[model samples]
Target: MSDWGVDRGVRVLKGVRHFRHRIRRKMDIMFDAYLNSEGDFPMCDSPVWIFGRSYSVNYDLDELRRSVASCMWVTYRKNFGSVGETSLTSDKGWGCMIRTGQMFMAKALILRHLGIDWHWEPDSRDPSYLKIVSLFADLNSAPFSLHQIAQTGSTLGKPVGTWLGPNTVCQAFKKLLSSGATGLDLTMHIAMDSTLVQSEVKRLCLSHPSINPFASATIPSSSIINTPRIDPKWRPLLLIVPLRLGLSDLNEAYVPGIKAVFEIPQSIGIIGGRPNHALYFIGYAENEVLYLDPHTVQPTVHVGSKLDESEKAADETYHSQKPGRMSFLAMDPSIALCFYCKSEADFDSLCRKLTDRFSVIPLPLFEICERRPQDWTTSDPIFMSSPRSNSSGGRNSPGGFTSIGLPGSSSSNSKTRMGSSSSSTFSGDVDDEEFEILG
Candidate 1:
C-alpha cells in the first residue's frame, strides 16, 4: 500500500478532514520559516522609522567595535583543549573597559536609534565605519609605535588609542549628521570657544593620518538646511550644548526634557576619577537614574561548530539582553554632560511638554562633562561669549541658536581664543554654578 493509504487506514479513527494536506502545508510553512531566519536567510535588517526615514536597526555586537582598531579583537578558549580559536575581530571593542564601556554603548545606541549605517565588516572601502571610528580615534592611520606615549618613569608607554573626549564626540556627531548620511539637516551650537573646537579636530588628524580625516568633518559647520520647508522635508536638528553640569542640574535641567517629548539621550562621561567610563542615562526611578553598562563582555553564542546555529544563537542573545541600571549614588562627583534639541516648531511642542510636566522653562540647559582630576582647577571659560553672527544669541539657547548656513557658507576664519584651563575648576557664583566642581 502507498504510504498515504497505509497511514489513512491506521489513523482513520479521528474525525479530522484533509489531515494529509494540512500536515503537508504545515510542514511547508515550517520549512519556509526555517529558511527565512537571520544570518542563514540573508535578508535586509528590520526597519525602524526615525525623522520620517526607514532605517534598519537590527545589528549585532560585532558591528559595534569596527571604528576602534585596538579594541576590535576578542579572545576565545576551547573547553576540550588548551587552545581556542579567535574568529572575526568584530565583537564590541572594550576601549576603556570598565571605565568607558557605557560611552561606547551610548554611542552605539544613538547611532542605532538614529538609523545611521554602521560597520560593513571586511569592507575597507565603506565610509560608515570610518565615520564611527572617527568618534573613537583620530583616524590619521599613524604607525603603531607613535600611538603609545610613556608617562614619567613609566617603563611601558601607555597605548594611546583613538578614544575621543566628550567634546570631540559631540563634534564628530555634528560632522556625521552634516555628511548627508542622516536625512535630517542638523547644526551644533557649542557653548565653548570656536577656536578650541576647530583645533581639537585638527590635532586628532595630525597624530593619526591614515584615516584622512576631513577638516570640515571636525565641526558640524553651523549651517541651515535649505530643503523644502514642508512635511517630510529636511529641517535643522539644532543641538544646544553645554560643557558640563552638576548632578542637581543634571536632573533638573536635562532630565525633564529628556523625559518629555524629545528623545535626545544624554551620555555621562568623566565620572569622578574615571575619565574612560561613559554612562548613557536611560531614565529615572525616584532619586535614582537608570543606565546601560557596556563594560561586561557580550559573548557570541555558538553551538556544535555549525554556522547556522551560531549565527542564530548570537542574534537571539543580542535581542534578549537588557541594559544594566544604577542609582544616583553610583554617580561620583555628581556631574554629567549632555545635549538638548531646539530645532523647529516641533521642538517648541517638546518644550511645552516639559513645561506641563515640570512647570519649568527649557532654555539655559545646565549640562556638564567631568574633568580629568589633574586639570580640574584650570579655569577656561565654561560659558560661551558673543560668538560670530551665523551663531547667534537669543532666548532659544543658554547661549543662543545661530543658524550656520549651508556647507560652503562663510565661517569666521579668525580663531576664537581657548584656554589651557579646564571647566571643572570654577570660582563662579555658587548660585550660577551649573556643574559640581569637586575641588
Candidate 2:
C-alpha cells in the first residue's frame, strides 16, 4: 500500500475504536439502570406511605411499584435548544433543582387531571397523561420545560446554567403558573418566611372563579360529577411551602412532620435533596425517604400534542420504574413542600391534618395561621409583585435556605410568635433567626 493508503487505514481504525468505546459506555449505562431497577431498593417490611396512600410490602408490593412508576419523572436532558441567549443546550450539571421543581409541578397536574388513583401502563395512551407529560418536554414550547424554567430563573437573579436552590425553583414555578403559560386551571401560592397563612391561601385559591374545580377535558363529565364538589367558589390550589428545616442539615425534630406531610391526601411531594444535588421526594418508608432522582442524563425526547407510536415510546423516558431512597436525616436543611387542594374541603382537611400533627410537636416544621398577623407586613417586592411583574431582587444562595422572622424581635424561643410584622422586609438571603409557628 502507498503512504496515503496507510494513513487512511490508521484513521479508520481510530474511528472504529471510538465507536466501540461509545457503544460500550452506552451499554454500561443500560446495564447499570437494569441492575438498579431490578434490585437496588431496600427491604422495607413496614407499610410504605406514598403521597397519602399506604401499601403493604408483603401483599401490595406490585401495587406499590406501580404507584411509584406512575409519577412523572423529569430529569436532565441534552441536545435541546439553547436556553435564552446562552449556548447551554443541556441541564446536566446545574439544572437538578429546576428538574425537581418540574417533577413537583408535574405531580400537581397529574393529581388535577388524572385523579389520585390514576395508574400508568407502559402501552397506555391516556390523553390526560400524555398531555401532562408533553407539558414538561425539553422543548421551548412546553410550559414547564427546562428552557422555560431556566429563563424564568434569570428573571429572579439566577443566570442561565447556574445552580438554583429549592426556594428559587419554587418561586420560578409560581411565576410560570401565574403567567398563564400553562392552560391548566390551577393557581400556585408560595408561603414565604416559613409561614402558611390560611386566609392568604384561601384568597388566592378562591379568587379565581372555576366552574368546576375538579373538571378536566380528558375526564368524562360523569367522572367529574362523581368527584364530590365541596364548593364552587374554590379553585384548585398548588401550595408550595418553602422552609429551612435547619441551618445546615435537616433538623431531626422536623423529621416526623415531614413524614406526616406525605401521608396527607393533599400532599403532592417535596423538592429537595442533599446539598448541591436535588431530588424529587415522593414518599417515605420508615426512616427512608423515597425520591425520583434527576441526576440521570438522557437524550432529549420531543413529546408533541398528539401521542403517536413514536411519541408514546419517547414519553416512556419521562417515567421511571425505580425510585431512589435515602434517609430523611440525610436531606438538606433547605426544602420546599408541595400540596394540591382540589376543593374547599380539601384545603380544610389539609389544615386540620397539619394542626393535628404539628400542634403537639415542640418544634413544628412551619406555622399555620388563619391570616397574616395583624402587625405583619408584605413588603417582599419579588414575592408580593404581580405574577407578570418583572421585578428584580437579591438571588438566594444556591445551597443556603431562606428564613423570615418578626422584625426587631431578638427572642430566640422556638415557639415564639413570628408574626408578619410590617416593619420586616423579606429577603432571599439566609438568616440565623428561627420561624415562629402560629397555633
Candidate 3:
C-alpha cells in the first residue's frame, strides 16, 4: 500500500477511538460535577480536576503545607541522634534539644520558595565534607563518622548527638555563606547582639586562615527588621531570635518578610510547647493553627547497636511529613525565627501584604481563656498569660509552671495561677543564663 493509504487507515482508527473516549470523558465529567455539587459527596476542601474531570477526594492539610514551602522533612530522631543526644527520641527524654533543626527546616522551606537550593546531598568524594565534619566536631566536641553525616543531614558545627540551638544555626549559616564555599551569599543578623556576631566573625577570620569559616560574611550594625541600620537593602535576610519576644515583635518582624508561599509566616519556625518543641505554622482558621511538628516518636527501635539501621528507618519516616492542628491557645510559641528579603524594592514587595496586626501569623491565645486551680495540670496555663504581660512575676507554686501573672491579678495573690507541669528548662533559643542542661 502507498504511504498515504496507510496513514489514512491509521488516522481513521485513531479518530474512532478519540470519539468513543471523548464521549466517555464527557459523561464522567458531568457525573463528577453533579456529585461534587451534592453536600453528601466526600471531597477535599479544594477541587482537583483530572483530565478535565473533577474528582471528589479528601486530602489532608500536610499536602497543602508541603506544597506551600516545598518543605524538606527531616525527623528529629535522625538529626538529633547523629549529633550524643540519642535518648532525646524518648517520650520524656529531656536531653533532646535541637531547635536548630526546626530553624533549618523553616529556612529550607523559604529557600525552596525563593528558587534557591539550600540543602546539599552527601557525597563521599566531596572535599567540603571533611570541613563540615571538622567544624561540626569543633562546635560539639564529639566525633561523627562520615557515614553518619551522609545518612542524616549535614552536622556542620553541631556537636554529635547534642543540643543544636538556634544561635548555633544562625552563626553557622553566617560561616557557611562567608567561607564562599557553599555559594550561598545569604546574610544573617543577630537581633539581640549584632556586635557579638560581628566581633566573633572577625576573630574567626583573623585567627584561622585555612579553616576560617565566615571569612567573607558581612556583619550588620543593626537588626535586619525595624532598624534603619542596613541601607542599599540586601535580599534574603534570615533573622534569629535567641531571646524571648512578644507578639508585636513577631508581627512587625515577620510580616514584612513574608511573600505568598515562600515568605509566609510559617517560614519563621516558632519554638514552643513544653520541653521546648520546635514547630512551624502552616495556616490558621478562626480558632485553630495548623503546623508541622518536627518532633515525633521514633518510627523504629535500634536493633542491638546498629545505628545505621535505625537512622535508615528514621529517613523513611521523615519522607511522610504530616501537618497537625492545635487550639490557638495551646500553641504557645516563645521564639520566632524567619528569612526575609532586605533589598529596598524586594523588601517593600515582601512587606506589601504585611499589616501591623498578627492576623497572618498563627498566634496562640495568650489571654487566659479560663482560670484553673493551682493543681489543675490538665492543661498548660503558661501559654494562657498575655504575651504583652510583664515577664517578672511571682514564683510559680509547687507542681505548677511559671505564670506571667494573670491579667487584673495582684502580685500577692499571683500564687493562685496555674500552668503546665513540665520542667521549664528548654534547650532551644535562649541566653546562656536562661539555658539549663537537662539529661
Best by lDDT: 2
Q: On lDDT, who's better, 2 or 3?
A: 2
TM-score of 1: 0.36
Candidate 3: Cα lDDT at 398: 10
Q: Which stretches of candidate 3 lie over 4 Å from their true place?
A: 1-69, 78-106, 109-172, 175-181, 193-235, 241-276, 297-317, 342-344, 355-439
What is the overall TM-score of model 3 with all chains considered together? 0.40
TM values, all candidates: 0.36, 0.78, 0.40
Q: Where is model 2 more than 4 Å wrong at Cα? A: 1-41, 211-230, 305-309, 380-439
Clashes of 3: 10
The whole-model C-alpha lDDT of candidate 2 against the native structure comes to 0.71
Positional deviation of residue 293's Cα in model 1 after best superposition, in angstroms: 0.8
Ranking by TM-score: 2, 3, 1
* lDDT (10s digit) by residue, model 1, range 118-220: 3333324223323332232211121100111101001111122223333333433443444433333333343342112322222322342232123344344
Q: In angstroms, how far off is 113's CA in candidate 2? A: 0.9
**lDDT tens digits by residue: candidate 3, 1-439:** 9999999999999999999996785565445433432212222354422111222336533334334234433333433333234333222232223433333533432342333333233222222222222322211222122123321222332344444344344444444444344323344543331111223222322342222232343522110111221332233455443333222112223221222222243244443432245555544432334455556554332222123655334223433333454443343223334434434344344233333233445431121112333442222212223321323331221112232332354431111112223333222121221222212
lDDT of each: 0.30, 0.71, 0.34
